[model samples]
Target: MKTRYTYGGDEHVYVEVDDEMSLDAFFIGLSLSRLVREANIPGVTEICPANASFEVRFDPDVIAPDEMMARIKELEGEAQAQEKRLDTRIIEIPVFYEDPWTHETLMRFRERHQDPSGTDLDYAARINGYDSVAAFIEAHHSQPWFVSMVGFVSGLPFLYQLVEREKQLEVPKYLRPRTDTPKLTVGYGGCFSCIYSVRGAGGYQMFGITPMPIFDPEQKISYLKDFMVFFRPGDIVKWKPIDRAEYDAITKQVEEGTYAPKIAEVEFDLDAFNKDMTGFNAKLMEALNDA
Candidate 1:
């Protein structure tokens, strides 16, 4: 599984990996795990992790585009082949929509939280002790799941996916957007990836969060697009409510990057949220289906 090519003026190759999966897979694989293995490229100074993609920058004059492109194509070919043939696991996250599309939901959400809000809810959660993710996933079966945008943010991962789009949120850009839109935030339903929403200003619709974290500094990782997405490039998503135990377990998995919850405590009304949001509109899924 080792294939090498140059990308952005540096050499990037895919190496056959054991069955180990994590956020690092996205940041050119090993995001920061390769820090000690591969010395930082000269002139690149430091490469920071972001919510969009793991990156590196070298002196333009020293590294030519032709060389970079050549390497990129080589690595891209290899990575593409190794990716899962299908993203069959579209973790269904249950959301109450808070209130409803009419008045209550939007009103309450807008009451304290503004329209363009981030997933910085007031909750401090952490977990530890799990031998493998398999053990943990098994324990949480039938639990409620969530969907979020899987992006590398400052080395940690987070999810922010929208189940629906709203017209009121579609404000156009002042000037024409060109080559570098600065990769604001990324969201997905199937393979549809778009950079929208951020701490600053922007004009694009955003909704809902994923059941997983988009980043994890401790793990020094990132996630592959299909591996962390809600649906396959062709499958539809139907939001379903799950039990509180499952929600708590998976949430811990996302934040800690573990296969099981070791030493822990759970505190949240996940059951109520799931029950309230269980009767989600199945029709919305058709609109999202890539088929």
Candidate 2:
């Protein structure tokens, strides 16, 4: 794949690998980004990998822009020949579908939603061809979603499911943005699903709430001691549906600082996923479940 390199003002370089979102594009970007970080160029400050693109921040004075560009192109070529494998982890996130907090928030913003009369889940389920909201949640949990990008907020991750494009879920953003979305709100927009890390203004249709914290600035959770945000661009996420009982129990644990996310490291194979999605996903999930 040819990468289109462009300058971001005088300090950053943006490299786009593909025009559209796909796991293939993501892997290519991830590989190149990883190599760029490993190079540890004198001027490079940050490397951010996105859905189909990656960005690098650098000091032009220390390393000339032209010099860095040439190095990046060389790394891109090397990445193409390397195997498409990622050392990542799958995290199980528990969500209380149609929970009261988000339900109230969605009801208040119905006028902004596509269907003013229906709840956010009802509207999403109907548009996605599901007969009921419960069926929609079931379908959502059936497939694992890849964390293609982690932005828009501190720990908010934009998740793309590992399914054929035809089977992907799609939803429209609100006609108008909501002034406030509750923290930990699970939302769906376009072809991506997201968990709102903080309470803020957003347009994605709100569906549920998770008890676990994805962002803790204070590093309250042991897993997040190194970084407040828990997600990486290449991570995998599986949303586990829970009843109010489990939700409340987890909330209590979180308050007491006893809760920890269930996580398992796995090697993702891009070629195998492209050849056989079902088999690939089975193996991916088995690694997490077995651990």
Candidate 3:
């Protein structure tokens, strides 16, 4: 598909790579955004990459809108010619599936969910072609997810599973948003998965909770020392299912400032993954397991 360039008001420029969500579109946005950052255009103030598109905020006085658009077009061409790989890190995030807290929260807002008669996991499992919640949970943890974008909150990560389209899990959001969502709540909406950074209002289907904090204003955690946000656009996240006992242990470690998450550095080749997802994901999981 061709990339569409448009102006966002008078100070921002937007580039849309695809209408549908895909890894290729995400990588294109990532590549162009990185190239634009490297250019260090004087007028550009911020770069925001989304699921299948990216936007740049610029100072119109320093650089005209037309000039910025031209520069973006140039960068898009450059990105197409650049390497197909992106430097990324693999993070193993621990999750307690069917956890009590998230389950309670969902139960409290059952009227807001599409399937008011059953729990969110039950509804999700049925729609995803799984016979039971256990099988659904297994599918979720069976593959690694790519952090396609980090937004909607300070550190909320929008993840896309690294699997073929046919194997992708899909779910719908709640009919109405919940007034309160616990911090680190693992939620899913449409075709994407997300980890709520803080307790607040949300509409995604509640699944479970992670003990670790992805966002810390104080940055006390060693892993978040470089950046308060634990994830970036191209980061790979693997969710591991843990029991309540292990979850409590990790929570205690987090409280004591002694817990360290498993993390590994790896190069993600978008082209290779698109060509051979099964093989690429096997290697990706190996890297995470090695970590």
- Point to the candidate with the largest lDDT: 3
Comparing 1 and 3 on lDDT, the stronger one: 3
Candidate 3 local lDDT, 1-291, one digit each (tens): 689999999989999998889977887888899899999999999999998899999999999999999998987877777676778889899999889999889999999999999988899999999999999999999899999999998989999999889989899888889998989999999889999999999999988999999999898876677889987788899999999999999999987888999988888997788889889888888987898
Give the per-residue lDDT of model 2 (tens digit) for 1-291. 567998998899999998777887888888899999999889999898888999999999999988888889989878777787778999889999999999999989888888999898898999999999989999888889999999988979999998999889899999999999999999988888999999999999988999999999999776678899999887998889999999999999988888888888987888878899999888878877886
Q: What are the runs in model 3 whose C-alpha is more than 4 Å off?
A: none
TM-score of each model, in listed order: 0.29, 0.89, 0.92
* Stretch of 10 with least lDDT, candidate 1: 119-128
After superposition, candidate 1 runs with Cα above 4 Å error: 1-56, 83-94, 98-149, 152-291
Supply candidate 2's per-residue lDDT for 234.
Answer: 79
Q: Order the candidates by TM-score, highest first — what do you get? A: 3, 2, 1
C-alpha lDDT (0 to 100) for residue 192 of candidate 2: 87
Model 1 score (lDDT): 0.30
Compared to the true structure, candidate 3 yields what TM-score?
Answer: 0.92
lDDT of candidates 1 onward, in order: 0.30, 0.89, 0.90
Report the lDDT tens digits of candidate 1 across residue range 102-160. Answer: 12222333323322232211100002133443332232222222222223223222332
